[model samples]
Target chain A: MPKPSPKRKMVRFRDRAKCRFCRENVTHIDYKDTQTLQKLVTTRGKMLSRKRSGNCAGHQREAARALKRARFLSLMPYIS
Target chain B: MPKLNLSRVYEAMFLVDSGDAASWDDLVKHIANILTRNGAEIVGITRWDERKLAYTVAKRKRGTYVLAFFDLKNGLAVVEIERDCSLSEKVLRTLLLKADHFSVADMRLQLGEDIRQDVAQRLMTERGETAAVVHAVVSKPTHTGGEPVLPEPSGDYEPRHERGRRSERY
Candidate 1:
């Protein structure tokens, strides 16, 4: 992992965004739920990291796995 | 060796090609048979949605999704299931994974709404909408009421040419 530069430190703000799954009280994040997954990814079909998405470390990991599964099945684009 | 006793819940989401078939009942049954034949007890199968993909897959741009939940013993021949799905002509792609959170109640909560949405979508298309409105009209197309009437174009509707006319000048 690369060290955060001084500029990156200045950009840090308290994460106000709530984890979407926690907000929705949803425990199971299915790869087939592209509607929800789309929100977690950019138009280029890249998964947003935990910082930008405001996802907890645990849920973020799960979301990444689910998104990968969705990508593997061609349910989602590798490069939208 | 204790892995032999590990029974796990799995969810499989299949993208099916309906371009040639008039009905999906037989296809769904065939998928269920695949699960049962592989020793996975069926939990529920839900019609997730039908829509065009972001990019072409297998030379097809459109597909219908079937989300199936089942139980499988760990180390079960999941590869065989994968092989069968790949071999089947009706399936475009299949995603299988362990779903520890699925429950019997979800059968109604998920599939029940999915079935209702399917009917509503059919009705909408019958009234001259398109059959592929997976994200159109109602997000959760439940049995709300009588046939939905397409809303009239809002007053804010403006011609595209009009917007560019005043802005095109150098």
Candidate 2:
């Protein structure tokens, strides 16, 4: 009898959570709104990736732009 | 090109020392004069906020922000205004952005009675016309609700349960 084929390891992928902006129907991400932006960044003031922040591709792009603007205005810190 | 000379809306934020807040009227007039001198039409002007800086800028710990909206035909006017602001002793920093997304009504709504005396009077007389126009333009959700409410640097974004998880991991 032929040897049984070795079992291959299965890779598990987590389902993506819904983006907060999409859930709230937010169209524009205001750089002045630091409260919302704070939630999207890490403690060290680095922006979180879409997977980690639960932002959709579109909102993630806007968030990145807004965050950079906020940093320039000194409305948000560049680093903690 | 003709398109380059076409009028466009712009939003500018001016940063000044909080100490000069008393002479806000003068600063606003000064800014208005600069825009007018550059052939820009004044649409609206408002005081955004006064707050402590995240980082020291121009050796100032606190600053006051003045927001202005205008229509300008010359694109070079923006460069000229920025140059003037930098040279002025009253202004510490400035940030200007294209504001085509906003409408005249939206801009007018931000105009306070304390702004330019003539503009304020004109708005008072044309209140009905302005209100009708406001309904036509899609209103923006107000983001200038004073300063940003900063939560504690710790334990705000993270949930209570998740807070302990970090310590446990270490």
Off by over 4 Å in 1: A1-14, A17-26, B1-7, B113-170
* Candidate 2 per-residue lDDT over residues A1-80, each given as its tens digit: 97654442111113444677887777777666677788887766777756556679999999999888878777778976
Off by over 4 Å in 2: A1-18, B1-5, B108-148, B152-170
TM-score of B-chain for each predicted structure, in order: 0.61, 0.68
Where does candidate 1 clash, by residue pair? none
- lDDT per model vs. reference: 0.63, 0.69
Chain A vs native chain A, TM-score per candidate: 0.76, 0.78
Error at B26, model 2, angstroms: 1.2
Model 1 residue B54 lDDT?
Answer: 56
**A37 in model 2: Cα distance from truth in Å?**
1.7
Residue-wise lDDT of candidate 1 within B64-84, one digit each (tens)? 767776667744578889999
Docking class of 2: acceptable
Q: Model 1, DockQ value?
A: 0.12
Name the lDDT value of residue A28 in candidate 1: 59
lDDT tens string, model 2, B1-170?
A: 46655667787878888878668788878888888998887877777777777778889877877788777878888999999889988888888888765545556655544345554345445443343444212222244544546765342234223345552331
